[model samples]
Target: MKKTAYFIIGLSLLFSLLHAQDFTYFEKEKNIWLQVYSNQLKAQALDSDIKALERSIKEAGTKKKIELNQLLQLQTSKKKILDELPQSFDTMLEKITVESVKDINLIEYLFTSQKGKFNIQTQRLKILKQEFDDAVAFLTKELATTESQENRDFFKEYQLKKALDFFENASGLLENKEEVLKRTKQSYMSELEAYKQTQLPIHIIKIAILFLIFLLFNLLKYFITKKIDNEDRLFRIKRVLNITFFLLILLMLIIFNISNIVYAATLIGVIAAAITISMKEYLQSMATWFHLSFGNSLKVGDRILIQTNNNQIIGEVINISLFQVTLYESINNTTALDLKRSGRTVFIPNNFFVTNYVYNYTHDRMKTIYDLLEFKIPFTCDTKRVEDLVTEVTLEATEKYMEIALKQFSSLRKRYDMRSREFRPRIHFIPDTKSSCFILYIWYAAPYHQIMELKSQLSQKIVKKLQENEIEFCSN
Candidate 1:
């Protein structure tokens, strides 16, 4: 039993060591790539060098063999220096810097410099120096232009200088990044060493699967676009689908915890948080959409007064979405005939309504009543006689529209325990406080839209009918 336990423990320890080794190697490779990505200046210089070298090689016709021999000798010398690189990566880096400086001196021998070429080279060097100065200025501005002196000191003394030193060293090492890349590629190609037998199939399969996934995604997008004409909805669906698929792919990669899924997830989460924070306005609009979907407060077709810009707009609700609530714009409580003006739609942010007062005129028609018209006449006009005259006149004028009003009023009143008598138009004669006369109050059933017209017509007809009946007018 003791021997078996020892064997198992040894195997576990070996597996753990192998796992750590794999992680460290992978991390180092990734970090190297990241460093290369950060050194854009070096990359550009390398590209320029490669182009120049290529042109020189192409131009050298008769001297091609001699030029090639010189280049080979220089390369062999650089390789010998590289071979003597220190075991310590840091020390190796220092040696690499020294070797690069030596290589720069050797470049003069490889390329013949004319008198004018020296001037051009001097100008180019001057430009490069100016670029470094500009970089320093930008970095200093970012670091030093801080509210706190302590923070500025930290950046100026440590971070800024560290970054500057890194850039400077990288710039020196990358005398020609393109040439280095070419040499590396040439070496790799010459060796052409295949990956381990077990790893080759896995890598091939991964590439094939990635290709298939891309094809499938495009095909689905094509079909989905055809089905959904709404660009916003399509974009949302596509974004969600992409995220889901990406997660699935990541999960598959991390099934054995061999890949950097955790790192990827952390990066994605940070990026997502940044995006959400940046797009706060858009997110607020989305919150308003959620309010519209579940909230029983506002609905389409309801007449509401939205107070924004210190302006009140009472209109019928036309459209409701996440970002905006569109209302068919109203003028003087009426929808315009022309769709552009009165019928214009106002797209207001959903959250704005919550912050401000949203007057829903059509919340429940039962709780509200239409306009109540009350008219005053002299007491001498005979209270009972006047009521009869005015009531008859109102009934005659409103005969066509009264039925509809009564129907609406009846339907509205059913919800409340409102007094049954409040639904009808009643003429009342009350004592006038002013001008020594009693006021004959004529109450009538009316729609809000035609209140002005109805009142004017009723008044005129009552006066005419009274005069024809030889009724005496009361004096103030």
Candidate 2:
């Protein structure tokens, strides 16, 4: 009860102090403050702002409930003006003069609390506010009527949205429109961004379609080429296509008529020359192929000896080409006996013909012979009989091999148009130690294989023939 009495005493003192200020100035200030604060509430989003405004009125203990309800309605009329608040702090403050206007009545009431002066200022502010409200209401009505007529005439949803955007933007300039203005501005930016994003897919689709056309053209060209067997016809077709495509590319590169065609053609010519020079070695190889084709140089089957790195390769000609030649080594063979000793082939450059000698055995002469002699007569034997026997055997062997060689030569001569009949096999006496007499020899058509056999056979026959002739031979 004592606390309640003290509160009542303080309230009475506050009321008396407010009354002593002439009440009129306080009344006008109270009305303007209430009007501006309530206008801020209405311009905000509907639900939160309404609840906030109710809470604010309840918290203002100086005002009665009935009086606050009336102020709320009066302030709603000023909501449009309050909603014109600028986004920028400076611009909004300048436009609304919120602080200045709030302090004006307070300062006037503090200086001279007069009922007449307070009423005049209050009436002026009310008139100004009413004019603004009336203009807003009239304009809104006119716009609504225009929209209704346009709806009757038929309006696109897109056009309506555009109009909504314009009106929302204009309404954002009001004194207390921050919340709604910010939301609407975000929506506008999002819509514009969506429109820009949609155009990107349009460009992507155009690129994809162009790529598809290019792939289709390449596939068509591949299939068409596969169907043709004649290389020349295909090459001609390719050349024409290449020329057409070249011109098309040129046209694309130089879209304007003022571009220099001659300069571009010159650049192309330079590139072609550089390519040709780069492939000069290949061209030289092609020339070698031409030489082989024209029957000027040795072909695949010609024998040759290539001196390389201080070593000699005597081999049969196996395979030949513009760039390389292959050989079957013939060094270890008498009658192609060691032909298999070396691997299948050894490749030699055709350009080797320019600096190396080629030897073709089959092409040169067929009656070639290599002869060797081995004597086994004893030291104690009659030297004369041995000499005669050796002579006779060697002569007989020579004659036998010569006969076979001449026959083979005649056959080859006829077929190859080669005069190999002049080749003859011969034998000569050679120096030997006292224990043996050697038969030096030249032979036709006999290889190292048959040389041993022929010597053995002749030795046996000479012994038999000399024995029948009573030839004395010494025993070893």
Candidate 3:
């Protein structure tokens, strides 16, 4: 009876040990199977996502389609990874089950390798998610700022919708990937926290410094230019300061942020090339404006005559800008017809300065130009008498202008080696044999704006003097 009881107890103990060993093996197999099942589900979801992205690409606009294709490539790559992971896990799981291996260290090693790969995937997904979030935010901002209903509708239907869809899909995938990583005894949140600790503060400092620099420069610009009274000079100075400010900021940004010189140079070169190509005409105009501003070739309130397409435009400069020069058309000796079009504004492109000739009537503030008065008289008339009368009338009409002109000419002479000339009124006569008459020419100095008025005064006086002297004028 004692031998029988001992045998039964030993048999029970042996059975219990066998059951415990089997249970341990089953638990490990079950966990791996669960991982396999989870990965398969993820792979199917990624495949569906890739297919959906391909379809969306077809329905999207040109730019949107390109973005969707990129998304599709990313999704396909992820599915490939998922597809590969399941095969690897299955092979390891199969080996464990078929070989009935009591130790599954090889499976653990495979899982460890897979965790590293999944971590890489997680990082990629994080970057993709950030890009999508930025795209969606940008689209939202554009939609809000767009005043046109047509534009708003287009953005909502196309850009915003596609961005939102991409964001949603990426977010779902990221969550699943993070969940997988958690099960592998790795947490993405810890890595993220480490990155924030290591890098985020530095970025924050850079941004804060950039903002402060921008503010300081703006304040300095305002303070320096606020006291200036000359509007034209102030505007030109402001433009120069603005260009300097932009270059300084750009240089500082490159210096502060870009560690790689090769990359920085390439980026700068590319940006410069794009701007030069896209804004060729405008840049030319701006460069010409710089020349005009510093060279003293043009200014506001100066009377100028520009010849364009065989037509003459005489006006007073009202404004000079980077792109164009504005003029207020006025009556002048060069273009008398401008009297009817007086007060009208004319805009000449700044780049026109390169190809066209501009005649500044009031150059160097001289404000005076020589004007001619011509009339015909019979050839039989006394030449001496006509000359004397014409000269007398011109001198009387332009008495005040002669002194001012002489002073201006003196100043101009100091600056340039000018040819000497008689500053006072002069009279000349040319016999017109075809018409049996002599042309009496009177030249006088007059203000640019008052040329017509001065001419009228001299003409009335000269004609009266000729009539009083019985000098018969030729009808032709």
Candidate 4:
């Protein structure tokens, strides 16, 4: 009995050693995960601090410009560290995916204990991207607003340069992001396909039945719509249902987790944001177009004058678009008396609404303007006769046109929300210091297109009348 007991004890000891040897490899893997867990905890703490710093940077006022470089350096370092940590986790995950986990509990460990590590790292990266963008934008604004030359150079060198470089480096990850995502999706898809294999035949049969039913239903709907006269509406419905089917397929991919949907969506969003930032001028112009369109602000055929480059660009607004406004050139940099068209069309950006002041002459009706024109006469001549001659010649020239303007304005008031401003031909003889003559201020109101011609005619007629009346005029 003693010999039998020794033999049994020896056998039990041998079995224990062998069992330990079998699990020894997995035990080391678990230990490695433990070390990763510790690193993850430290990373999480660092991420929290980084977030705090980002908040402070955002809230920092203009006075904090000097400290921006230091803050950026620290932030960049933390982000770099955080960026480095993911490689370790990703390496482990790659092993997990590639290697067969013989022990079922190891898979559970990854889901439970290591899940936070994965999720937190992803969040850290996402937050870092947003923080970096915010910092860059903030520093740019600060640079523009800061009066200090020192601060401007500091921002350009340290803040903007570093931030842009970091962002560019981070985006480089996207170069292989597609490949990584493809592998991940394939790994998940392979698992899903294996799972589906068990009941694939049955599922296929069910799917075929449903597909036939859907096809039949669509055919019925098509026939019904075919009888209706609204072919366009029916065609649109068909397109919508087809798109729905496509979305349903994508939804199934997501449901199976074979799509790498999150990574793909995030990547596309980042790329899209980059594209949008690059094309901000176009987008802003489009937004401005929407604002103008909705506000019913400006329209074609409305005469407009915009002040630009210390010159008033007077033209008839020929065409209005999101990108540009086409203007038929009427009067240019010369004199207002230069009413002849230069035959040059002006293409003005829609963004002109902000920096340049737009003078829309014709809002809801035809363009009519009152030109304040001044002419000098000798102070020795009778002021009363000059005023009467001026008034009479102006009246003779514009009487019929003014009558028409009154009627047109009355009709325009009915059509649009406007009050009429009138200008009857009047000559005011004001005292002049430079010339020994009274200034004949002619307040002429007429159609915009005809104002130049009418003014010329009025001037000639008044001079002829003055010459007949023997009135002396002064020259500048």
Output the number of the lDDT-best candidate: 3
TM-score, one value per model: 0.34, 0.31, 0.46, 0.44
Kindly list the per-residue Cα lDDT of model 1 for residues 1-476, writing each as its tens digit.
Answer: 54554455445435434433332321232333223323332333334433444544454555554664465465445445534433222332332211112111112323532324434544544454455455545545544554246445442345445555665665553355334534544443333233233444666677687778778888988899899999999999998778677766655545523465775677667756975898777778788788877876788777777766665676778889877888876654223322234656778887676578887755544222244444455545666776677678877877656566556557657776765444345676667677566666565666544555666677788878878877755655
Query: RMSD of each candidate?
Result: 27.3, 27.9, 24.0, 25.4
Best model per TM-score: 3
lDDT of 3 by residue, 157-257 (tens): 45335534544554555455446545543443444455457766666687788899789878876886788888889888888887787787678768864
Instruction: Select the stronger candidate by TM-score from 3 and 4.
Output: 3
Q: How big is the positional error of residue 15 in model 1, measured in Å on the Cα after superposition?
A: 74
> Candidates ranked by TM-score, best first?
3, 4, 1, 2
What value does the lDDT take at residue 12 in candidate 4? 48
lDDT of candidate 4 over 76-185, digit per residue (tens) = 68667756654243454343223222222323433533334444544544554454455445545544555356545442344334434544564455334434544654
TM-score of 4: 0.44
- Runs of candidate 2 with Cα error greater than 4 angstroms are 1-284, 331-341, 364-421, 429-439, 447-476
Full-model lDDT for every candidate: 0.56, 0.50, 0.68, 0.61
